[model samples]
Target: MGIIDNLEAMRAKGQDSALMRYSLGNEYLKQEQTDQAIEHLAEATGQDPNYSAAWKLYGKALTQASRYAEAVEALNRGIEVAEAKGDAQAVKEMRVFLKRAQSALDASG
Candidate 1:
């Protein structure tokens, strides 16, 4: 009856898509289930490599999980995708997230 239930039902019906996976990832992120979020988000990006939003969220979720190196990687790709897609807002936000990830990476070294 919740968003996850509905989304899972859709997936069970063979309705998989980048959007579906992105939504799942977003919901999992909201629940602070970074591992599940990462899984779905990775799938979302793989399903549609050009999905800037998914890439952004994926980067964010990675950062949240303290996977700084991977966060930096995902954020870099997300910025490139957003730039190509003319998503200036997403690009700006991703840049901020990138800086955070880079800082975390440096600190860990």
Candidate 2:
């Protein structure tokens, strides 16, 4: 079965967790379903506010959807979470995405 099928099975079994939601979000992002990705990623982040990876993906999905302001918010919060967790890689990645989102906002306004 495909990833989504497996994920759906997991969800059907009520196996909801931050990781599960994050995986769903990532899968949706891969499919270019930014809205769906945002929904899952938001749930993931809400379930675990310290989830830097989820925040990163959430920001990226928002950016892909042209929601630069929200992307900036997510990225900023992600950077803080990453810093707190000593996840330098995540912080760096989020910074890059943060800049991209800022640029989009600048260009649009």
Cα lDDT, all candidates? 0.97, 0.97
Model 2, residue 62: distance off in Å is 0.4
Q: Which ten residues in a row have the lowest lDDT in candidate 2?
A: 1-10
Candidate 1 ranges with C-alpha deviation above 4 Å: none
lDDT of 1 at 16: 100
Model 1 lDDT per residue over 47-107, tens place: 9999999999999999999999999999999999999999999999999999999999999
Query: 94 in model 2: Cα distance from truth in Å?
Result: 0.5
RMSD of 1: 0.6
lDDT of 2 by residue, 23-64 (tens): 999998999988999999999999999999999999999999
Model 2 TM-score is 0.97
TM-score of 1: 0.98
Runs of candidate 2 with Cα error greater than 4 angstroms are none
